[model samples]
Target: MTTTTTTSDHADDPHLIGPFAIVPKQDCTHLADHDYTLPASAKRVDGHQPPCTDCDAIRENWVCLEQNCSQVGCSRYQQKHMLAHHQNTGHNICLSLSDHSVYCYGCESYIDSPKLVQLNRQLVEASN
Candidate 1:
């Protein structure tokens, strides 16, 4: 009696697997070795901004040091409470100069004096 063994018998054969089949397994190792550095387009450092004291309690969009409402229509304008409200409402507080003084009307806080001039300058330059 003769028995026939078909290719299906060796279907699990490692040698039969093509390069494409093995490519995905290598991806993890490649990713492990990868530096994952920021892109060149991200080379420019962000300009200095005041730190949020209540960042732990705030969300990303609403983060601000000023306690004023960053929202345009909202009546609440107190700096500390506004920061909390802004965090809750997902509003971005404006941080810019007004009447030759650096202030964020939205957050209702003054920026650091050292950075205030530079920030105003940047705004002025951008407007031109």
Candidate 2:
């Protein structure tokens, strides 16, 4: 029996987060018929998911200017403009795009991807 998997198949799968999924990479063709199960340890934990630590720090240090918004905005709506307004008011919950690290003055949550870091820098600068 042959089974084919695609990104869409894992779109709603709890084990799938961000861009990674169980589908075979374009270069690999041998495992097309098998269902791959990610290890339990790889599954994300409830509430223990990755934290935007920088955002948390920012909230701790600064108060939001928008009456209805927090550092990341409301649970129902998140707007960058609102977040920028908060930052402009001295909330420092910005993350480094180059590495997905949060900059909390001298304290940082380092996310090692250079591309993400660069992207984050661009976003912060643009917002400013």
Candidate 3:
């Protein structure tokens, strides 16, 4: 199936910017068929399907979830949208389908931080 993005970038130098640079792409296989509720954040989707927070359009709004929105009071908070990892935080483990989202491990954009694996191992050891 062909992957179509619902977002784009406006650049005067169109040749300098590639389509991939702004395309809100996602691996549909990992996406839930229906919209799911995120009670903790209280972000709701009016669309038939919950928007893929990582790369799909939500309702009629299209945003790039690849990184946390840098806009002040953009509605998407830094804790939810930013993927900048810390040793204290194992991963940007966003289970939300709104605000901040992530790609599946198999997806090309997935971040496989060495820190995440190390943290997981530590957790296992502590539990054991």
Superposition error at 66 for model 2 (Å): 16
lDDT to native, each model: 0.33, 0.32, 0.32
**Error in Å for residue 25 of model 2:** 35
**Per-model TM-score versus the true fold:** 0.23, 0.18, 0.23
Model 3 CA deviation exceeding 4 Å by range: 1-20, 41-102, 110-128
Q: Which ten residues in a row have the lowest lDDT in candidate 3?
A: 66-75
What TM-score does prediction 2 earn?
Answer: 0.18
As a whole number from 0 to 100, the lDDT of residue 3 in candidate 3 is 75
Q: Estimate, for each residue in 99-120, the C-alpha lDDT of model 2 and write its tens digit.
A: 2233332122212233234444
What overall lDDT, based on C-alpha atoms, would model 3 receive against the true structure? Answer: 0.32
TM-score of 1: 0.23
22 Cα displacement, candidate 3 (Å) = 3.5
